[model samples]
Target chain A: MAVASSDTAIRTSRITRAFIYLFLLLFALFYLLPFGIMLVNSLKPLSEITGGNMIALPREWTIEPWLSAWSTAQIGVQPTGLRPYFINSLMMAIPAVILSTVVGALNGYVLTKWRFRGDTIIFGMLLFSCFIPFQIVLIPMARILGILQIAGTTPGLIMVHFVYGIGFTTLYFRNYYAAFPTELVRAAQIDGAGFFQIFWRIMLPSSGPIIAVSFIWQFTNIWNDFLFGASFASGDAAPMTVALNNLVNSSTGVREYNVHFAGAIMAAAPTLLVYIVAGRYFVRGLMAGSVKG
Target chain B: MGFLDIDNVTKSYGAVEVLHRVDISVEEGEFLVLVGPSGCGKSTLLNMIAGLEGITSGEIKIKDRVMNGVHPSKRNIAMVFQSYALYPNMTVGQNITFGLEMHGTPKEERDKAMKEVAQLLQIEPLLTRKPGQLSGGQRQRVAMGRALVRNPDVFLFDEPLSNLDAKLRVDMRTEIKKLHQRLGTTIVYVTHDQIEAMTLSTRIAVMYDGYVQQLGTPKEIYDSPANLFVATFMGSPAMNVLPAKLVERNGALHAVLTGAEGQEIALRIENAPAAYQSYKDADVFLGIRPEAITDPEGADRNARNIQGFTNGVTVTEPAGADTFVTMTLSGKDCIARMRADADVHPGQPFEFAVNMDKAVLFDPKTEERIG
Candidate 1:
């Protein structure tokens, strides 16, 4: 009986290991293919890219597109470069991400651990507001911003992004806070930690994942936003997203695909860098918050 | 003067009352336990005393100072929650010294207190480990140590041992009892586990339906419960309450019980209440504890009259040390405790004795004690 059992165990271990290796190899190919194609296409000259299939590597690669995207390029009569738009996007996304996440964390701390009236109703409204499309309110939102008299500035875009970004950030933090054992909060309270003390010392340090998630989401939303940025910002205050759109879809100009693609990559760079730096926190945040809710 | 006094405390959520008019006073160095079933308002009362919850219409005093609106830290009370409530992100040493650090104890004094508490709890070697890295028993000791370092006016525990495993719970229970004896501080503990109440408390307050049913020493509460609720709530396997008829026999009161074989047994009741004297031929409930009823040939048969009450066993369950025998008397079910060597068998009826002198009688309609 012992001999037969040992043989069966050995066979089972081998079979399971083989299955795992096969599964991993298949997933590796699935992920690496698209990235490889995007790299090759980005490096190739525009003539080579449009002449051949995307899978082929370029015989001649040039850095002119990358350099041009960083310097002077214009779609309108008044000449201006993409540099200011890149800086504007940076100004909008970073502050929007930071303020939205800070507010979300505070809101989460109040709603979950503190028992007060109408907390559930407020949370439900926040979640409901996140689901509404931004286009539905863009016109009214633009008028409101205009009435506030800060329509064509960086701060106005930051405020608009923060307002739209709060719903999702709160949803992330609130749901993450719910998974925490409430006993910890009570213990902090008993330890003489008042509202801000508990939030800053005990709760926020352990809140790395949720903060990363909230930042990434807000960063991407603000960086990639075109309609709001276009409606709320004009002239030199417009973000890199609108600048890249003008480069690609100009009403009547020679469309430079290389500069537009490079500019597009630049516009998407901030969120992508954020994702790389906080990659583990982002993954853990998704696993912890999204899986539960 | 008493160390702590709770004056006519009452709690209600909206229209439904959870705790009703509870008054208790604890002498210095006393260990008091409030025990009941789920939703019995024991935890609510403890929370109010801890200043974690506001009192609806009551006042709590610690060291002669009224503590109604005071915050928990200002009240000088430390509570150990059932969940241990350790800061998960903190090490054992940090958790123990958090309360001290908050109260502005100097750095050297805080370290001294941490050393003393860690040594007392035997958690010195676990100082660097966070709560999640420790075992359940270790976490429990750290929780106790957290409360110990404060040296507060009072210690409140809300079912702190309910989360431990069975063997750990027994070990922790003894440690808590020993700690009370050694430290001589005021403690108010709440639990639904009756054995914890019976073994650890200087006094046990039995609560039910938002009211204190009875308050007395452990022996007093066990031997002389105030009502049916107290009698049934305090014992393991519970007290056997059988329906019977009260009657007058030879100018004395007796309980008339009919056995399964249709035989009538006349059990003499001593010092019967005046209300029961007029309850002749009236249906009443007979409350008898398991220990009060014994085997016909048990050792305590001579000290008390083994014939004061008698019943026949219907089933017997031998639990290694003692046997529990279920019997039917007057068409009502009751349990009796017998020796393990009694040789009682299931489905075989055997004669058993009941100590009517210690039995309590309750009115069937109101479920209240006759006396």
Candidate 2:
């Protein structure tokens, strides 16, 4: 009986592992197909792309369109081939991520740990702001920005992102911090840790997942934004999203589909690379926040 | 001067006053334990002494110096938290030495202190491991080591064993008592466990509703409680209290114990308070420890005498070493701890002798000791 059971267990283990590998292989192809199509289309010449179906790879791969997308096309002709716009997007997003996450952590720390009055009202207000539609407030916000004379500048975009980013970041941190034992904070105080000392030494060190979550959220929100970029950006400060929109929607002549696809790929590359590199952190961050909170 | 003095300390959160005019003093190298139930401000008062909370309107002095505005570090005190708040990131060695490092001790001296405490706590092998990697007992010992390495003037422990399992709690309690005896440091520990307080404290401060109800040696708190709350709160199975009236019978005093169906058993009051003699039938409360009222054969002849009384058994619980018998006396429920050999049974009437010598009398109105 023992020999028969051992034989059955070994067979089951082999079959289970095979099934797992097949499942993962299938799942990978499901996501990679669209990215493959985008790459093949971008590398193809306009004549071949216009003549064939969407998913087909080009018979002859050429670097002309890549160069055109980088230099000669209307999308690329502005300010060192849309490089300044790429810089603008990064400049706006990094600081916004930093500021929002810092404010969020402090807000969260106070909301959960500090027993002061009116803290509930403040937390409620932050939660409520996350539900307010950006469409309803865009026009009034633009007008206000115009009056403040920061309507179309890079700093203005950063400030807007910072303000809008606080709601989600604060929620993330507040919920994350609620799981922390209050006894630890009291112990730190009794151990001679002051306010900032407690935050830096104890609270901040344990904040890896929340920081990753906040960073990813803020980066995606700021980098992928088109409506805000169109409304707020002009001239050299226009982000890559605005440039991508203008490239695809231009009505004066027949569209250069190859350059357009290349530009699209270029515009989407930074976020794609970020998602790939920090993908583990992204999933772990969300999972940690869900259960830990 | 006492090493630590708390004079008229009080605490209130907004409209709620939790502690009211609490006073406690501990001499140098004394181990004081504050024990109480939940919602008692024992933890709050300990926090106040550690300078984590503000006193409502009183003073706390350590070593003849006012500690009102001094920061916890400047006050030169160390505390072991209830949760054993080891720094999650630091290893056990670092957790024990972090305070010393903060106080700017030399590296060699810091390592020496850590080694000494680790050996003392029997945690030398766990020094390189983080708090998350250690067991509950290991973390507790590490917390103690952290507090000890500081060599503070006063060590504060806030329910440090409440997080452990029962077996580990008992083991740690014994270790803590032995540590106190060996080091003889001035320590103020807070716990809700009566056994822990009884076994570890040089003096136990019984707290209730934020005030120190009584402060004395364990024996004093056990034998002569200041009030009904302290009397009942300090003991296991608690003290048995029954209501009766003080009556005068023939030139001697007696307590009239009324039972069901108009059965009145009169018992002698040998050392009756002078105030009781004035009122012939004044209502009073008789407080007796569970061991006081027992079978006549099991009664200790040399125990302190209260007014002599007799009670009828209504239930019997034999606990091997001793039997807990519950009875109806003076129209209220009373419990007594008797010997296992005392043949007690429920539903059968038996009169148990009461040792009135150790009994305490309390005024019904104020719940304060009458004599």
Candidate 3:
């Protein structure tokens, strides 16, 4: 009788497990379906893309659209490729990521360890900046970049991104350092390490996971930003996102769906590559930063 | 002048005072343990000594040098925190030599110091491992090694063994005592466990409510606690305090206790301290250790004023080596420590002996020891 009861229980558990797997499969398909369409369409010619069958795999795949998007694609009056803007995005993002992360780490160290009067209020103000929409800062940022004589240049875009990105990077590191034990800092101080020495030797070494998180987050935000890129840069200094937008909305040409899709995919590649490479650390940083010891 | 002096030190956070006018002096090579229950300001006092916390008032001198505003590193002290606080990223060897490295000690000298500390702590095999890979006891040893490698003027341990399990805590406590004996470095250790304070300290400072209740040798604190707080806080199974009337009977002082059954028992006081004479005919709390009230067979027969009385046993708790027998005295439950073999049954009359000479008298109103 016990064996019969156990058999029934096993059967019920098996059915429940099968249902769980089926639900997860559908959930995965819901997210992967759009990327599948983009991939299949980007491989096809414009005629097949404009055809009614959007979900079907392409009959004949070709790399011509990707080639055209990289080299001969028209963005504004220039017949130059997204190659130049891609380099422009890299120049802006690399320096922005490095500077913002360093500043954020220093801010985190000071706010958490060397806190003085009204430090929390200052942190709160900095944290409040992270939630402000870009639209709110668009006009002021443009004037500030113009006054600094860096407008219409990549440096101006880099500075704008750095200023806007500081809030998020600071928030990441502040929360991470808050969870970090204060005793380690105290011990380092008692070991005769000064402020910068402790930061360089002790705090920075332990910041591996958070560094990946902040870099990835800031890189993705600056790389994909279109509003800041469009308002602050022009012509030769335009970022890939701005160039991609111009490519899709060019008024003179017949609509080229495949080239636009290819351009979109190319613009997203760096962020996707970042996530693929350091994705594990991103999740670990989130978990470790949120949970206090 | 002592080796380390904390003169009238007080600590206040805003309007709230945590440690009030505390005074402590440590002679060189003395193992002083600051022990109290939680929130007793023992750790605060230790932190002040280490220069980790700022003193609100008074002066702290180390080696006759005023250290009021000295940095912790410049004060030449090393601390072992309760959490061990080992750098998770560094190996045990790096953790030990970090202080020396910061001071720009030569690599060979740093390596020598690290090797000596590792050998002294028996942590040589664990030197290459990160703190994350170590067990609690191993982490504790590495923390001690970090402090030992510095060879500072004083070693401060802030409840370093409190994180370990019971068996490991006892074992580490012995290891620490042996380490102190061999090194003979002036040490200030803080712990909430009185047993650790009693067994490891040359002198124990029993603190309560931000005040030093008593500071003396372990035997002195155990035998002659300053007040009800020290009397009760220092002992496990706590001293039993019973209200009694100090009556003058035929030119002799007697503590008259009325049991729950309305029966009165008078125990004579012998060689009472001079302070007890003024409390005649007044109510006082008779403080006696559980060991002083034992089974008649195991009682100290040679004690100066041994008195035996019959009372109804309320409960019997046999704790392996000794049985804790509870009975009623002055309408309050009083626990007596007896030999495990003593046949004690609840609700039955039992004969328990009391050593009156070892007993203490406290004024009921103030709870301060009178004799």
Candidate 4:
């Protein structure tokens, strides 16, 4: 975007630009150093990693640890792998992200366009809920889960993440829709459209950027959350984070460092994929809701 | 009751009332303009009529049906908003017929109605283009087309042409007036531009500070204003108001004021209203339009009493077809309109003609017209 600007700003010498680029490149490589070490040690046998330098390239590359981490990594006294937990995380994150985003969009529509008495207070309370710590709700949530008799289930974990995530999603959507002209809603109402019809036709079509922002935010938070997963879910219902913790801890004596690296990378892979795919819209959507009057 | 009636309608947000007892009745095909400065409750009144804002008191009826507690969509009324309010995601054709589709009209019929409206608006070539891609004028046409496609009982226009440039505003004003003439649909338009109100409206309701200062035909509002507010608000170079005293000389009513040189000048008033008989020696406000005072040669030949006076010009502004000459009368800058070629300059004494027949008198105490 800056390259297209024909503005006459202060000019910099070639050597200065070269030094700036070199500094940025070095900082980037420094951040990537841990990931580089993890990647190089994940492919070698455990014996080689123990005897050799961890930063060095693989002496003998093999897929045995990858296969072991995916299946047969002895996760919690059972000869199971992180694959089922990965699937559990996906199932939990997908529905929770979608439900929270949709409900938040509805909340945003009503708060901005169809405002009623005490709406600002309701929105203020929703925003206040976002700052609440997860530990504060653990006891009450556990009690509710027990009463509902679905404690430690995948649905229960999804419910926990969903209940906690809607506040943030609503905040994003409300600010974004605040800048949307209220005249369009009034015009639609006069055009014989009802409440939900206006929302579906007039509003949702232009909500692409904000929805992308909400989806990326909710997906990242719910997938990376370990506290809620460990507390609300158990056994085969554990998310990938809990399963990976079990895989590393349940191993006795000789630590399979190579398999641990593989399992850790596997747990972080989905979030990495999400950011790589939709990260461009994160800043764009945030800016859309920020700079508008 | 007329076709659309706003009967003693008042809108209040809690304790503060923005609109107070707005009573306007429009016969079929009558174009009533609700015009005022911003925050004068003109738009609020338009919204109340459109059913967008609920009325706190009184009632609004369309086609003689009471519209209280009725939803906007069920009111069968259409409004063209100030921003145009074209749906950004829909194309021109779809935007035009969205209301019809929402009403469960068949696909083929919706398309037919859309085409007819597009043809009427001469936007047939732009049907597939989205609103973001269209120019400002074209988007305005599509907005009007959207309202026209519905064929509702009453059309409410809330400053629709204000978003355009100066030239486009004039052009669209003409187009709207033409549309009203062709369709003969009852329209309640709102605007702050007084010229639009005077030109397009069959009757103009001039508002100020949440009060309807005056309501009458454009000519009536121009020639016979109800108060000082209407007289000053309805004209471009607003009607000049000079403080004067009403006196009786030679057994005829006369308005006596000071000239530019501080000399006493008296203009005889002929055919005065009966109310002036009681205001013999009381102070009064004399209102006269710019065009009513012109060069001796440019004065209206048909005027019954064109009184000539000599005043020193303080300013001369050449405005193409007419030259506006300003001078001090009764210690106020009184403007006189003359032909562009009138040899007028500042610091020069010139003979100006005043058409006393067109002059209006207001009571100094109440500011209301004397008769």
Candidate 5:
């Protein structure tokens, strides 16, 4: 770690740098073994996976399992694919991520810049949402969802995730903005920019890194949620994670292990894509707020 | 009413008042400087004038209009912050025109105003660049340009040059003074450096402990400070304040004190103020600047009462342009400023000249000026 931190140190010691890279490569291969196994089996035929080595390369490699998992797979006595549930997850996650981020940014701006009495206490109470056990709130959340009359719907899951996501998003934003200079806000006020104008023009423009952090965080949490999807949502309204479970556990004919691996990978694909695309900004955002916003 | 009136304004957070009954009225185009050490309420007073902070009581008026509850932007005033506060995401052109844009000015007019200010401040080439790309001096010019393009009724500066290096600070100080002269705009600048206050302001209000100790012209504040705080706070190496006896000698008033040689010396008062007669034989403090106590050759030749005395020099520091010699007077370390070429050294009994015309007396108990 120390050898990689400085250019001079790395240049002066080739043996140490080589050794560090070798160690890191070994660890990388070790960590990727499970993912490699899953991908390798997902491409093999069902007979090869049931009777042969799980880690062995297939003699007849085909994408039949991935296609079957997408369209014709049996999930809870239906031949309908996991595609609809994928759309459900996307719908729930995208709106939840966006709305929670906007709300969190506004909360952070008011908490740090436009401070009023007992603001810290209000923020403390809001933080309770982050720490409260997800299981503990299951009943109350279900009650609220029932009262809203949108139970078992995509919007219902969005509301659940959006409300639950605010605490973490707000936490990220407030700390980032706390390091921001208040003099800039005062200068804007003197320059005749109103509250919303300053938020949109001044605060939001400068909040790129934190917004990326919030979006990535909320999207991953909301998209991969199985407990909430299983407990509250049902049938066609179920998210990809719930539908993937039914595909694997349904006591139907053939018990296809290849299709189960494919369905599991499909359920995990969106989060992997999100992380791969936004991974660089996620690290930068966390580091920026951790060191100095 | 003057062009700007800060009449009986006092600011308090809750029960503790930070500014106490402050009253200063600035005339049209007068540069009023509020100077003090940090936390002495100089910045607070400037904020109140800019309407960034509310005035606790007593109304502030600009052009005879009450501005107690007016918004900062509605007050028609602009402020240059110590940090410059330029928007980092905007180009210099946009930063300069942001206020005009917010005020609903047309694009053509905003562009024209920004171009005029950029050219005036000699930053036309930097207009396309963001503030993050500009140097410290260029950033300062942009901040000032933002304030100037508004053509405000008043310009408030809260230690704007303090963020610069010493050389840049001096250069910017001169530029700000030149801009003030060319525009003749009423400006209330705040700084802890007394040199800036003296050089830049038409009138200065020296504050300490939430009180404006004195408000006068630079000459008045320096030559005749209202009290001990003003006298000591306004000069470099601060004014020498030592104990003395206001005794009558030879039918005239004299401030008698111990010289460096452990012998009594009497410096006569040439034209004593009328109240000095009443403090006969009473303990008082004598105030004198380092320049006032000089080598006999470097003494003010035109001073009516240049009383000469011999004192032992303990330390001689030959600073360029002038040499400072420290000696013991009235059992306190008194420094005297002498010529750079003055032949003086430690352990030498040097003959010093005291100009009585520049000397002021302060009452011992009250610390207020007696003469």
Candidate 6:
């Protein structure tokens, strides 16, 4: 009798587990549904997309929309493409990511190992920058860019992103470095290593995970940023996000929904690639950075 | 001039002082151990000596050179941290050779030094492995190897063995002592464990509350502690402090202690120093080691100050070789190390002998030793 009841209990637990998995599967599908529709519609011709079966696989599959989005799409008065804007975004993000991450790393090293008076207060203020609304800085930033005479250029956008991105990068690096043993720095000092030597040989080598995290975070933010891209860049200097916005919102011609979807995917592709390649490290870095030693 | 001199060092932050004006000097090739409980500023003093911390208001001289404002690398000292502090990203060989590389030593010379130190530490087989792959003892050896490769003017150890288990700590302590003996390099070690200080150091500085209470040889610190704090802090099962009245009896001084049943047991203060004369007829603390009070047969029979008495034992703890017998003296608990073979039981009277020549007395008011 005990065995029979235990068997029933096991069956009940299996049924509960199955139900839970089924619910989770449906929840996951709920999130993936929009992307699925975008993917399906992205493959179809304008005629089929207009027929409005958005979730169905394309009956007449074509790569013309992708080609058009890449090279021949009309954004603003220019008929060039998102290709230049994509390259522009890369140019802006790569240097910004590298500069901000390096600065943040140095700041983290000094804040943790070579601490001065009121260091925590300084860190707190730097962290506060991460929370300020971007709208509040837009006007002053525009004026600063105009004053610097680099307005509507890629370098101007790069500068804007670097200045704003430092707070988050510093936050990541500082919290990650806080758990690092200060004794290693002291040991290196006693070993005759100077400040930069210790940073280069001792710190940076051990900063792989946090570096990935910082780079990904900065790259994603700078790449997907429409506000700063639209505000600080124009014409040839416009980033992919701003170009995508122009393409989607343009009122000059008939709406090409497939082209819009393909352009959106292209704009989202780099960050998605980064996440897919290093998603595990991203999570690990976030966890390790937040936990104190 | 001494090899290393810490003259009137005072460390303060804002209005609070963590280390008072402290002074210590050690000759070359001397092994000095600074010992105290936690929050006693031993680590802070070590940091000052290493030039890792500012001296606030004092001069630290190494080999007749004032090290004030000097960087740690320029100070020519190597320290083995309590955490080992091995760079997790580097192999043991890289960790050992890093100092040389930073100093711009040639590749061949760096490899030679690394090999020599690694062999000395018996970590040669493990040199290629990272710190994460090594055991605790191996990691400790790697840390030492890192220091040893530098051949610095002085060596500083900050409780390097405190992280090890009991058996490993003992083994490493002996290894450190052997290494020091072989190298004869001047070393300044810091530990809270008095036993480690006693076993490994040529001189021990007993500190308490930012002050160096006593600085002497291990035997001197053990046999003649400076005050109540040093006396109580430097012994295993610590020195038992019994409240007693110093009474003058027939031109001699006697410490009058009451037994558990209110009976008086007068222990004669034989060879009492002249300083005790002023403390007569006043309450004092009679400090005695557990081994000083033992079973009659287990004591030094020919000692001039041996005194035997009967006391009621409240507890008996047999620890293999010697059984610890607890008794009451002047309304306080006192432990006596007795022979394991001695037939003694709790709740019964036992005969015990105290070697009074080794006993010490402290003034009740100042807690300072009274001769």
TM-scores, all candidates, are 0.91, 0.88, 0.95, 0.98, 0.97, 0.97
Best by TM-score: 4
| Candidate 3 local Cα displacement, residue B65, angstroms | 1.2
For model 3, which pairs clash? none
lDDT of the candidates, in the order given: 0.84, 0.84, 0.91, 0.91, 0.92, 0.92
Off by over 4 Å in 4: A1-10
Per-residue lDDT of candidate 6, residues A60-99 (tens digit): 8998888898999898878776899999999999999999
Error of 3 at A98 (Å): 2.0
Worst 10 residues of 4 chain B by lDDT: B17-26
Q: Write the per-residue lDDT of candidate 1 for residues B173-254, one digit (tens) a residue.
A: 9999999999998899999999999999999889888899998999989888888889888889898888888888888887
DockQ of every candidate: 0.58, 0.53, 0.69, 0.88, 0.80, 0.87
Which prediction has more favorable DockQ, 1 or 6? 6
Give candidate 1 misplaced runs (Cα > 4 Å).
Answer: A1-38, A46-55, A72-81, A249-254, A276-280, A290-293, B273-276, B301-304, B308-311, B347-349
Residue-level lDDT tens digits of model 2 in A190-253:
6667778778888888989888889888898899998888888777788889977776776756
Residue B311 C-alpha lDDT in model 4: 88
True contacts kept of each: 0.52, 0.55, 0.60, 0.88, 0.69, 0.95
lDDT of 6 at A63: 88
After the best TM-score superposition of candidate 4, give how far the Cα of residue B286 lies from its true spot, in angstroms. 0.3
Residues B185-292, model 5: lDDT tens digits: 999999999999999999999999899999999999999998999999999989999999998878889999998767999999978989898899999999999999
Q: Rank the candidates by TM-score, best first.
A: 4, 5, 6, 3, 1, 2
Tens-place lDDT digits, model 3, residues A88-156: 999999999999999999999899988889999999999999999999999998889889999899999
Off by over 4 Å in 5: A1-20
lDDT of 4 by residue, A46-152 (tens): 98999988988887899899899999888988878889999999999999999999999999889998889999999999999999999999999999999999899
Q: Model 1, residue A180: displacement in angstroms?
A: 2.4
Candidate 5 CAPRI classification by DockQ? high
